[model samples]
Target: MIDTSMGLKDMSKRDILVNVAVLIGFIILCMGGGGIMGAITRNDFGDRSEWYKALIKPSFNPPNFLFGIVWPILYLLMAIAAFAVWTKTGLTKEPIPLVIFFIQLALNFIWTLIFGKAKDLLASLVEIIILWLFILLTIKKFWKVNRGAALCLAPYLAWVTLAVALNYKYWELNPNMKPDYSWFVLKTEL
Candidate 1:
């Protein structure tokens, strides 16, 4: 976009190129954030963990690969939605929507840790319910800023809703299971 009052029609080629690059950068940044966290949380590689394999899961549980596939797509959509909101209000103005977005994203990572890493069924379920609510709050806030941005989060909300149910099922199946936290506390040699 043109820096001045001129319309897009007046944007110079360099300005257009820079804008495109910046947009791409935003997408990469957002998706990369999720990719890093997802890697930290997932446990489906190399014959899978015996602990996870033994845990009773719901009949409707999805294949592990499905998670690897679905999350990236969802992250991409979230990135696009965030970019849309940023385009509307920049970073400083209309900060609530973006703040909610980050909060939800953080909660997302926390749920994975509680469920996947820590193996705390009850905690994961509770955390996910909060995450789902925050997702809804984000959608409502994004709607006030950009309808398109809000719509982009719909699938995410749906996925998290499914997750909430799945986590509940896990909790029911593993009521007495204690969370493993030996890995959670970092061990280091001084």
Candidate 2:
């Protein structure tokens, strides 16, 4: 007597909505983290070409323009990967995997602050190694849940490895360089 076909249609629609919501949340979390950190640093990633160019850098350091192109794509991939895993883990129900995911994300933001904002090359180099480890751990945990999700983090891991090398190079090249917060601050003299 009941309308079984209608019930199935409603269920499919609900499932689709849930998937879309998860994807959107992941994007917001991933991109928003970068956005907030970049804002806190006054858009150093995009606006500091002159300052970065003046610094002594290694031969392998990519042109300043390359970063602006790469980061958004990486962030999007990362978000999709996390969402893939989260869906398998049942959102808030899976605690450990989610914890590892968040830990890595937090470390990611901290690395940006240390390297780009604080300009603490030596400290950032150390922190980046730790960040890389956490990322590896996150990927491992994600693999047990979803292989695709794990693969998504592979590029991120590779990029962080390069970042560690770059950080070390910056530290090695500029031994006596000091953190210059003045560059980011606005001065008002009467």
Candidate 3:
């Protein structure tokens, strides 16, 4: 009986580890997807020095550096929420909610490509609205599986709402500011 109990405990521990590993992998995938999409869409690559600084931002805008800090934590939370749903219902069973989560994530990456790389502020704003809608749907579906998972998405949704407003404000302030590809060239001699 003691040996059986030990086996059960070990199995449970293994299950926990597997769940944690899956969650971390999902988060990393989301981050990597966004990074690659951003890199591919941007012509100038690492040269945000010119475009970002030249834009007229609202006084309420948070420092650009703050975005770097906030998104990783939010993405981790999003992954945890997704993992919680996956573990609760198994991956194949929760198709609708899982699809919603993926749709929102795709939109999240697309928004960066649209606004940051393409410099289409209006299109980005529209895309963010779609993202917000999908996020709401994901939250609702997650709530059905696990309330904690639903709650985990709250910060991400809030941040995106703030981002939408910021995008609009930037568009309003810099109506004519289109991204120029020439600004991306480095000064190094060939």
Winning candidate number (lDDT): 1
After superposition, the stretches of candidate 1 with alpha carbons farther than 4 Å from their true spots are 1-9, 12-18, 44-47
In model 2, residue pairs whose N, Cα or C atoms come closer than 3 Å (at least 3 residues apart or on different chains), thus clashing, are: none
lDDT of 2 at 155: 87
> Each prediction's Cα RMSD?
2.8, 5.3, 6.0
**lDDT by residue for model 1 over 1-190, one digit each (tens)?**
2242457679888877766775786677668877776678656221376767777889988887788788888988888888777777666866888888889988987777777788888888889999999999999999998898899999999999988988899889878888987768989999
Model 3 residue runs over 4 Å out of place are 1-21, 35-47, 179-190
lDDT for 131 in candidate 3 is 92
- Write down the lDDT of every candidate, Cα atoms only: 0.81, 0.79, 0.77
Better of 2 and 3 by TM-score: 2
Q: For model 3, name the residue pairs that clash.
A: none
Q: TM-score of each candidate?
A: 0.87, 0.83, 0.80
lDDT of 2 by residue, 85-185 (tens): 77777655666776888888899899887777777888889999999999999988988988888998898898889899999998999888677566458
* Residue 175 CA displacement from its true place in model 1, Å: 1.2
What TM-score does candidate 2 get on C-alpha atoms? Answer: 0.83
Residues 68-108, model 3: lDDT tens digits: 67877888888878877877676676577878898999899
Clashes of each: 0, 0, 0
